[model samples]
Target chain A: MTAAAEFISVSKRFSRRAKVRTLAGLAGQWLRGPKRGPDGLLPHEFMALQDVSFAVQPGESLGIVGPNGSGKSTILKLLFRILRPDRGQVVTKGRVGGLIELGAGFHPYLSGRENVSINGAILGMSRADIRRQYEAIVEFSGLAEFMDMPVKDYSSGMYARLAFAIAAHANPDVLLVDEVLAVGDAGFQLKCYDWMARMRTSGRAVITVSHDMYAMAASTRCLFIKSGQVKAHGDARQVIEAYLTDLSRDRHDPVLETNFIKTADGVPRAEIKSVELLDGLGRPVTSIGHGANLMLRFHYHAAEQVHSPIFALTLFHDDPRYPLNLPRHYLFHVFSGPAFADQTLKGSGTVEVLVEDVRLPVGCYRAKTYLFERDGVSPIFVQDGVARLEVDRPDWSDGRPLLEHRQRWTITSHVST
Target chain B: MSPMSITAELREVAGARGLAWMLASREVRVRYKHTVLGIGWALALPVALMLVFTFLFTRVAKVDAGGLPYPVFVFLGLVPWQLHANILSGAARCLTDQRNLVTKVYFAREALPLSVVLSALVDFAVAMTVLAALMAWYGIAPGPGLALVPVVLAVQLALATGLALVLSAANLLYRDVQYVLQVGLQVWMFASSVVYPIPRTGNLKWLAWLNPMTPILDAWRTCITGAHFGLAPEFGLAALISVVVLVAGWRWFRRMERVFGELA
Candidate 1:
């Protein structure tokens, strides 16, 4: 029962801003010690992971799930030795193969034929091993005729296929992947999963990092991370359930909270001030009963007069009853944009979109809002999963609400000969 | 915890030596794949430089080549000098140029610069053929000193690899290293006496003694043309400096490799 890879209380951090790397900047930093703030770290440094520990046993697959920047990739990088931990140790038992950022190792100018040998070497495959697997790789990629062509000319699918083929043939005892499972078409993605499953069945460990909850849940075990801390770890099903529940617990009205310090891209024409989810009485609420009246308010600040702008909102649900291949998809997308209003706004103001009765699967859901200029296609500002909405089953019902819709319907029976 | 030994550090890098050659060959193949000249560019650089310096030094500067013909003497120095210069320039951008691979994949980070050196050695091999032709045309017979040529080249590789490791690691931190390298290479070339004979007995000899490349290029010239294979104190010093530079460079690079992914 030996583990293939283990992280012993590993922690790591990265600067929030690009490092000042010139001699002059380095000298200034040396003199000033980089201007530490209230925290021990310099003003710009943020912890990527904090004393997280885990192990992947041989034949066991571990999936890491998290929101963006939750340190899932850091764990993978630590195992692969791409990024060393600042404190604690990362130990791997054997040759580690990576599908991290798939096709990132391929030379664009080299032909697919040339890239196979090179990428195989990069994955720690011996020349003899690469030669032995060369035929299998080319066959699996199904690009035999196009092997001599430069990889740059291949479509993305071809590029990924060839890259995966070589990496699969690397034949390492441990596998590391970062969202590469989401690449290619659905059929090909299934192929990648099948490959990893085959590896695991043969007693090799597999560690994958992804935002895809379905993929995470399918693994033998899952780890949920939030803001550099491991929040939950155990059975894949329970860990994913904990993450979804954490997503639903937005108690402080994080939706309308404006301290999200993302650098504005250039000077935006208009800035999103806040987005609020309100009950019919004009009071903000994170959760609402099923079929209750709901209104979405988009607040904005305009530096100057702007022509009619489009405000769009979409509600997404990862409802399990649908059993979609992907765990999440948009349930509804509504646009109050383009010709919705021909008028211009000069300053700060708010716009509202009202849904009379919200009927959705009885679970937590996410909402994404976007603001675009007159043409209405280009986004000025976007906020995703910042707002959560819940549709509870009506108290009158003793059973579950309908999965598709909550509506009255009458059907006449028909007999077919 | 104890710091890692240099042997262990280098062994970790050796684990990926095959990758180094693979990347190097990929570079060579890609560079010459569609070119009509192919590897002619490698031959072109030193021969073209020898011709330019033959005119400039023999006619305008009126410098003596210590009784040897200007083309043979200068080409001897140019062959190894080009190897040195190519590796230096390659090392300056090695980490940054392969930024994607550096960040996304895990291997010994030194492989990037070492591969750059390997590609430059391709150029060195092509340029050596022209030197062989120059020696034959001059009717210079190979002497007993000719056997020391590999030893000279070995020392030269040590020096080039050491500097490459330093430059590649430094360039990853400060982009200014690349810009500095352009001007630095010109000054370094003139200071190393690639165009003139190595300074043996003058105040300039002190400056020549200080430059690590001077002894390397001097050894190349003497070893090829059957000159005295004297193991002078200066030569010993240069070889010692090369070993120290190589050991230090490997140590420094291994220490800095932890941040390569983040910086890249």
Candidate 2:
């Protein structure tokens, strides 16, 4: 048998102003343009889906993992036929059902039972067919008592339950889901994930787009999409590893390139461009071993006069919600003077703050920069979300501590019988 | 999903009469529930239209329904015409009316129109009952063709359903189609021989013959008029047209089914 779904070199190019062009272009093709037709007559074009091809066989659940705006949802839409492809074709060999958008086919005025029949039909069921499966659909939706009530009266969870019940009970050969588990409460999310797992076991080809790595790790077979293209198309574990590595690399740049933070205005606001955690001799440091010296390098450029500027660095965990502020002992004070040294200072300068035998917990952290005048006015410039650093502490085979650090973690492995 | 595989699923929608009855009852109950006169409105509508047309055509225009009282003739055609008009229009916009389920689940797409048609059938039956009472008051004895009314109505329904499927699918992609159909139905009601019968003319009769509704409505008039209306030929052609439209609509719907999820 042919594959459950096949995308053959399918590419969709969308004009930036396609909507405007479509409206205006139809009005008059009778007019000749001076040079081109008209500037706004045709919109700019860009490819949303590239010349990508993939096949999903029966009993395979493919997880699409990618960065935001990497055409993950577009793939699901193509499979669902929500939008026609501009190029190539998507051949589906089986009945296709989608939980693409929740509560899509419901009528506010219609009762759950009435909507179910209509919804079932839209999903390719007959009236008689929906009637036969009516009880099952109602039970699954958990709206047995409320079946007679109109859908407008349903709560969001009830709406999702009804929607999910309809899509799942459709029993289609191919299932296209996009972040369905992203809705409702945690319990409902888990329920949907469980249903997906059962669907995978039933030999139905399932294409799911999700950001939840744990769910992908548990249920999917082929992890195919990472940042729009197929990073690892076979093993789920390997693909996830590759995706995570890419994510880490993106967050932590190796070159330690200087990124200046400007004031609210677009002018060359701050004197110091950026400051990054670098190793000895000004090399970028990432995942430094516990017993190594770490240096915080400051790259500064003064567009105009700098008056008694003070550079301050604060360390905290990566999460801003509840940052674990570093102990003051971890701080290595560098050059302390009349801030910018002189009110006439106007050139580029590099300042390094070094900490020897740097030891912290094995985790990722962010370094914040603040610039202030010697008069103790509020810091003129504060830049955040700029830089990140990772600390790695090696461990032994028996789960015992291996790497030497000023502070040590004591633990004993209790063998449970 | 392949159309062949969905047949079993489609058949199950109509298998549960209770389910159909529940939906049908909801439509009926809701319409009359808040009304002071309840279902009297259903009877009053046709009676009122008949009286108005009877006065205007008989007294004002000096028109006649082949020597029969204008009220009775108009009433006969109006009963079936109203049902046909309501079902066709309602079912055309049924899918858009029920976008919630279409976007979410896998169900038979035909059920939306089917239920609306089913609900309107209840209204048709209620109107027919009032027609029976009016015929009795006028001492219009029953004829042999009276028994065939249900069969004639069934054919009318199939044609309406076929039209509904096409319009419903079209309405999903184009808003103007539904808007146009709403205006077209009123024009179509007058164009067909619903109120006044058109004398047999060269292409006029043929034009009426081409309209699937012409034969059904004409045959309905003949049934009550006790006239020899050779409706068999027209009915056959209309039935054929209904089937063609039905199949064409289904094919178009299936072809475009995949894109529905994306666009919708």
Candidate 3:
């Protein structure tokens, strides 16, 4: 079978700092001699993609999985010819349709109906083809009532729906999808997935870049990239497992070695001395697979006799840059209750919380332990990032970890065929 | 491997002609939509400029218009000048305005500037109709020289396309190009014989001839007014300059095309 797209030892480098933001800056840089380094990059420049080779034949779906700034999107752009490789060749056989970003070619002032034709054309569809599929596009978007209105008037959801609808109808031989599936409501996302599955069955090639693990697992093949290089590539499940292990190992270094001290002010009624994340077998481990039992053990010391102390452990995803920005409820959990009601702790004691079936996805998470008085309002001692927990699940057949809900269903039938 | 020849680059653009037309029509529709004047706005600019120039030059300054009616002469020159100015200014910002598409989607980048120019042509067509009506109102009969109007318009298009390509590409690299082009266009208008006849006996005469637009604008006035329309050596020079600028600008644009996505 012919390949829809192929890259041969392709490498791309970008300046670490954009020196051409202004005309004056560009002129000044030109006056300076020999700014490039030995790698043909200017000083402080770095490689975005380094000697990466991949191919996707007809009827194959290739999923590119990587963390942010890992060159996954750069590969898609190179395949679409938006960026040229510096050291190698990229060949795309037939028409390429890209749904790389939400509403990429849409104009705000044009009507949703008009934008469909224009955006479709931009994605390589002919005017005649757009006309033929115009009704289907509008129907699929479910924006027929607002088709005549300018897109600027539509809500953001409506705009994204129309953009996705038009791109879905372009029907190119190879489809390149970025994280656009993360947009819209769950129902629309399911529709997009169904459409993609249909395309796959119809023998069209697909290259997808997504952080969603379930989507990657569903593809025919997966590539795990790190720091502009392919770390592993093969079955989606195995590659995702490798990526998760690498992520946990990278995150474990700081938390596992350092001893955190409780810094909250008060009379120091009690202090968290140590925290450990153990696996199902009770062995101290940094990483545990999803749906496996894990234990959170906190060692604490009391200054004096304390009654009804509250112990709380909150989990946080270990994204240091933009922590606590997104909805933190799922990644954060508070385990607070009456610890030893009517009992007194004079010296040191251990508090163990058994968490059954850890359903968190494959990523590094830090646990924060807090000890409070009986009121559970005022904290006596607080330890931030006390322990690191890495949840890994190689099997994504059940669906996304966050979206998966376990339930039991049964049906009784009277008639038999 | 050989470098991409100009013919090959042009053929690549031609392959995306459908997309260019769709984008151009979208621009035309969006610009005129929800407006009261509705494409009358196109003619309104040149006509308003004609009234202002006629009042200022003929009444206030008492400038000569070569014995032609000031309104007709100024209106004719303003028509093509307005077209050229609108196209250049719009095309200059075209890539910047569509930076979203430039960074996220892949298409022939020329489609953006070319579509802006094409959309301005629709406005030019509307303005031309009003100019023809004004000429009739002034009782200026058509002459055989009117056959050269297409040639004159073609030359003007060549000049506009060339400059638009160059300005749009430069504007993408440096935002200062847009501001510079705005100021430069004001000076270019005055030097192109839009208000007054070119001075026949001064150092400025050669300066006017050096501006390719001067002969093209003069040719437009001559064709409509039934004046002497013989092909002068200056006209040949203007045509040659327009083609050279067009080819050179296109080559430069293609050379810089690879970086536009990064810069935008």
Candidate 4:
């Protein structure tokens, strides 16, 4: 079978215009002749994608994982024909649909029903096709009762739901979905996943761009891109592992250390020197698997010793569904041994928190550290985002890695004649 | 670099006709959503302008209406002028107003300005009914030249679409185009023969003939009044100019289409 989409050694460059004094300067250049590079770009230009190539076969899903400004979105746009490749050929076999931005064509004053047809057409569906699938789109959105209401009055969740429903029903042969899965509620995301699975079973190709590890792992193959080049490709697990290793290397660079300190109440008597996340073998790591041994080590110095000092570590996940500052887990330990019992023990030391069989889900978490007195009312030294930890379940193939708890239950049936 | 030929671009635009229609209806629907008079506003503007011009020119300035009722003659001129002005202004800003859609989604870029022109046409069609009633009130019976109204309107649409495409694309590159257009429309209205007839014998006769809108507006008046209503050489010249603008402006617009997203 023919490939659903293919990019043959594509390269794209974006040019920056040099400031000219007036239209005369432009006219002078035109009279003198064109001064452009071989790639049609002027002197001041930046390469966005360089010699990038990939292909997606029918019924297969390809996930592109990359850092910001790594030309990930550019690839998707080229595939959708939004942007032409500067050098190389981009060939797509069939109808192309994009979920790049939800509710992109929705008018605030138009009713949900009206918006469904309009958005569907924008996604490349014919009017007759939109009419035929209109009821199904409304039914899938679960907004049948609110179809007549203008979209501006609807909550954001409802608006995204309606938009996604129309796009999902358009039935393109090749689908390109950006980082839109992070929107809406968890149930809606699962619904989207189910729809994608159905599309795959029906032999359609999919290309997804996301930072979410779980979503990348669910795809059949993955590409790890950095600085407009493909560092690794093929085998979702291997590519993801390579990506994680690269991330850890970047984070652990000595020059890249984060200086998180909160000394608002004057220079505190205590200071947190450094923080590290360790794996099962006591090796420093930036990511950990679910139900694995993990350790968090904090190094600190105290100028003046205090009694019954409390050390706290808070883990926060920047969940798109909630406020940024909310912490997912909190742990507070009071040092009551000889280290803290002394009335005035001034020295430097290390504190370690060893967790066995970690159950945190697959997502990036930030650790915050604080030192307080015995009463735990006043904080001596507080630091936010002292360290970062990424949790994952590399073994799971389907469903999100949300938890690791196991349940024990038995069912019994009783019948009476 | 050129991505596709003009024929290919036209084919792509043809494929997006459904989207253009949907967008046009959306513009019409949203404009009248909360208004009490709904489509009555479309008629009110031309009628009000006609009344003001009739009082100012026919009475105050003592300008001749070519022996025709000044109200009917001015109404005929005002209807098409409003169509041209509304379409050009709306199309000039359509791309900027939908910047979000332009940057995020992929569709035929021509649809943006074309839909604005189409929506303005709906308003023009509605306003023409009032023109019909006014002509009947003056007892101006239909003539053989009435069939030629469509031809005149077609030429006007061609001219407007060409100018709209050029202005919209240029506006994206430099916003000064929009401000210039606002001030330019005021001057352009007086240059055309919308309010008073051009003097047959005067130093200003050459100026009137030089204005492309003059012949088009004169052709519309001739068609409505059925006096001196045969095909004029000036009308043919106007048609030729409209075609030239349409072709050249379309080529320039297509060449600049690739950079619109980045500039926007």
Candidate 5:
């Protein structure tokens, strides 16, 4: 069967600056004589998407995952015809609907009932179509009582619901949804997800471009793109796993590039110079399965005598959902017993932490090591990426768990006489 | 880019005309919403301009009215002039003003300019009612030439639609076009025979009739009095020019629209 929507080797480009050509600018170009680049693009033009291709079958939801400036939104805009592809053809079999912008054309002065008609029309529905769907749209939005009030009077959540209701009722054969679900209340977002699932079951194609890994895993298939090229495609969970692994790898680059404050008061305080994750045999490891012994080693140096210095180690998953809070959040933290104020050191040395049975569930985890004040509260030196850890899902495990808690349940039945 | 594709795109745009009409109606409704005088504001601009010109021409310039009431005479000119000016100014900024809609949504982009034309039509309809009231107050009766108003109106609409398309797309590209258009229209108004009596036959007639609006404004007044109104013979030229402008403007808009989102 043919795909509901397909990209056939599509390529799109943009100038270094947006192509705002005034008469004077055009005249200047004319006088200077134009030159073309290797890709047949004008000078200062760069290809945003370079011959990338993918498809979405009917009844399939495809999620696209990528970093910023990764040409993900460019694909949606090309498919929606807001931007035309410069090189290849983008084919869609039926009416295309975009959830790219919700409540975009709404006029503050217009009532909700009135904005329905205009917004519907702006979404490419006809007057007759809007009239037919008006009742259903208002009913689904759950704003039936507030339809006559000015849109400005509606809360932001109410506004999103109404906008979603109209676009959902547009009943498109292929929908291009671009991060619009990130807005609105959680309950409303779940409702929209339910609606999209229903549409998928009814044989509609949905292409979602979002950073939500969980949402991507829920799709039938996924495409992983980076730097204008396809890195991986097919099997939503696998694609998402690949994306996460690559993201953690990229996370290591910044740490190696970061310059740590190695000295305090022009004298070296005990500081962690390097870190390594080791196994039972003292071999360095990039990853290992759960339920195994793991060792963490920290290399340190000190130029002067330090009293009761404490070392802090912490572990956590790198969740893309909370980009700003990723590095600072810690799932578990531990400190040396030297905080009792008895231990003192004044030379280079190594410290080792070992766990007999690792309980971290299957996920990518980064470890951060810091040198704290004698009180073990204020950090004197910090390193973001001391070690990168991956906890693999064992063959016996049914599904990935947040924690590998060991538990058993016992039940006894007593007959009542 | 080909002729065939142009026809196809135009057919699609025709299908999206309903979107344009809805947006236009929404604009008209919003303009009147929560206002004290409401539609009175629509009538205010044309009437106020008519009063100003009446003062300028009758009291200051001491121009002859040649038997027609000065207020009635000037308003007849204001009706078409206002529609034309409103459309040009409105269309010139429609794309830039609604950059959010333009960049994110995909519809007939011509609809942006077309909606402005439609909203201006609403304002023009309101202004025409006041013109009728003014005509009644002056005791001027309808004549056989009243039938010719639709013809004059059609040519006027064609010109307005043509210019609307051009101004909107041009403004998106240059941005300077928006400011330039404001000053251009002001000069253009003085150049046309909007408030003065047209010379019958002379070098001054040549200068006055050379402006395309001269014939349109003349035809509007002569159509009221049931006169031949064909002396300038520029009506045929203006009609031809309107058609040329509309087709050319449409082509120009289509050529520039593919870049509107990225650049605008």
Candidate 6:
């Protein structure tokens, strides 16, 4: 089968940050600036998409993942023909439905029904087709009761939901969605993902850009982009792993270790200088087990004198956007802050939160720690992103040392051989 | 795409009840929105202009009115000129006004200009009714030739719509077109037969005849007031120019459409 969308030697150039551009900013920039590229009779040009070529096959859900300002959205815009690429061609073989920023097409004064019809027509659905799907769209959007109300009155979620319903139901050959699922509540988001899965299974191609990693992993082949170039593209798992690994490298840490802490602004004043997981003899270890004795030591300093200070710690596994594991519910332990101890020397110390058996799922956990004053009168200092811990299943099967579990296989069959 | 498809799309635009209402209601609502005595301006401006033109043409210039009242003479021509001007100017910039609609979705961008033209039809209808009432009160009945008024009005509408298509597309590419059209329309207005009857006495009468609008407005006045308009030659030329302008505007728009989404 032919690919649904193909970008051939597509190069879009845009100027580097003159300033952050808003709609009003765009009006001024394009109006005053000398035009260049395309028709070279103009002057002063910038590249947005540069010499990039890629093709998306039928039934393939392609996720364009990148950090902010990486030109992921610009690719979507080009596909939608909102902005033309100066050099190369974007050949699309089918009816293209783009929800490039949901609610982008809705008029505020029009009622839901009116907007639905117009938006459907805009998506290339004929009037008869829109009429046929009108009820289905209203039902899918759950806006049947509010169909007559002006869209401006709808909340942002309602607006996005309605917009998605129209675009999805249009049954286009190629669909382009840009961060649309980010607007709705969790339930609606799940519903959208479910619909997208159906769209994939039915052989309609989908191109989506989202910061939602789970959704990206669930339904699509992923493309990782960095500064307008394709960094990685392949299986979802491999691509996501590579992307996360690459991103981890971007974090500037002098210690060459993944360390982190979470804090609530200034209230609980603590800065974790270092975090190291230690074994039974307090030796630093990179790997540990489910029932291993773990020491989470937080090194910190006091900016000002404090009467009494408390430490709050939490643990998270795998995902950076959400914290899913916590060994303690901020089990605050009080200690004398370094300020009051010695007059000549500033005070600093380490607080170790020891876990007898860390009951964490098999994954990496970044240690999150916070420190605060007890009286709640004043905030001294704060810091986040302390360090990292790696955990696994414990093995004491033959009464050998648990550390032997790192070996791939048992030695029982070797004696008979 | 076939012409049939384009026709169908235009029908879809016209048939859309909400769009129709929006086109009609917004024209009136927007015109009077913040102004005092909003809707009254619709009636007041044209009549006021007629009085000024009558004073200038009849009293100051001592021009003959061809045996009819000078106010009736100018009003007959002014109605068509005003309709054409409103439709042309409004339609030319219609696409620009709905900038949000154009970029957000892919419908026929032509709908914007068409909507503006349709909306102006409401104002035209209102003025036509007022014209009819004034003619009756003045004891002036539309001649047997009055049946041709719709055809004349249709020609003028065609001319305006064509100009609109061309200008709307042009405005997208060059921001300067709007300023150009504003000044051009003002000059074009006086050059047309809006202020005085087409001057048959002057050697320069052919200049007025060359203006497609003059024949159109003259045809309208001729149909309504039983004025001696040299119809056969003038109407023939008027029809030819209207077709050429309409087709040329459409062809230019179609050729330039690919750039509109980018530039607009």
Q: Which candidate wins on lDDT?
A: 5
Candidates arranged by TM-score, highest first: 3, 5, 4, 1, 6, 2
Deviating ranges (above 4 Å) for candidate 5: A234-251, A256-265, A278-295, A315-328, A337-339, A352-366, A390-417, B1-7, B206-210, B225-233
Residue-by-residue lDDT tens digits, candidate 1, A1-417: 767998888889788887638888888778977666775787788889999999999999998887777888888887877888888888888888868866656888888988998988887887888899999999999999999999999999999999998888888888998887667888888889999999999999999887767678789999999999999998999998898778655434345422222335445456666668889788999788866767777777765556776777777774442233535466656677444456666567677767666655555567777777688766767777667776664554544433333221111121211
Please list the C-alpha lDDT of all candidates, in the order they appear: 0.79, 0.67, 0.79, 0.78, 0.80, 0.68
- What lDDT would candidate 4 get against the real structure? 0.78
lDDT of 3 by residue, A60-114 (tens): 9999987789999899988887888888888887778867876767778887878
- The TM-scores that each candidate's chain B achieves against the reference are 0.95, 0.88, 0.95, 0.95, 0.93, 0.88
Computed on C-alphas against the true complex, the DockQ of each candidate is 0.41, 0.27, 0.61, 0.42, 0.61, 0.24
lDDT string for model 3 (B133-225, tens) is 887888888788789789988998998998899989899888898899999999999887887777746788785568888888878888878
Q: Could you tell me the TM-score of candidate 3? A: 0.89
TM-score of 4: 0.86
Off by over 4 Å in 1: A35-39, A251-417, B1-7, B228-231
| CA RMSD (A), model 2 | 9.5
Q: Give the Å error, residue B72, model 3.
A: 0.7
Cα lDDT for residue A7, model 6?
84
Give the per-residue lDDT of model 1 (tens digit) for B1-264.
Answer: 124577877687887788899989999988898789999988887878888999998888887776678898888878888899899999989889888888788877877898999999998898888877777888988778789878888888998899999999899899999999999999998888688865677778776677888888878777788664224677778898899999898788888888888887
Complex DockQ, candidate 5: 0.61
Q: lDDT winner between 2 and 6, please give it.
A: 6
Q: Tens digit of lDDT per residue, candidate 5, span A1-417?
A: 999999999988888865666788878889998689776888888789988899999999999998988999999888787888887888887888869999779998888999999999999898899999999999999999999999999999999999999999888899989999988877998998999999999999999999877677899999999988899999999998898778876864346322334565764456777877888788989788766777777777766555776766777665454432334555545566453266565677766766556655445677788876577666767777667777665545544333333221111121211
The reply for model 3, stretches above 4 Å from the true place, is: A19-21, A253-267, A278-295, A316-327, A330-339, A353-364, A392-417, B1-8, B200-202, B229-231
The Cα error of candidate 6 at residue A106, in Å, is 3.8
| Candidate 6 CAPRI-style tier | acceptable
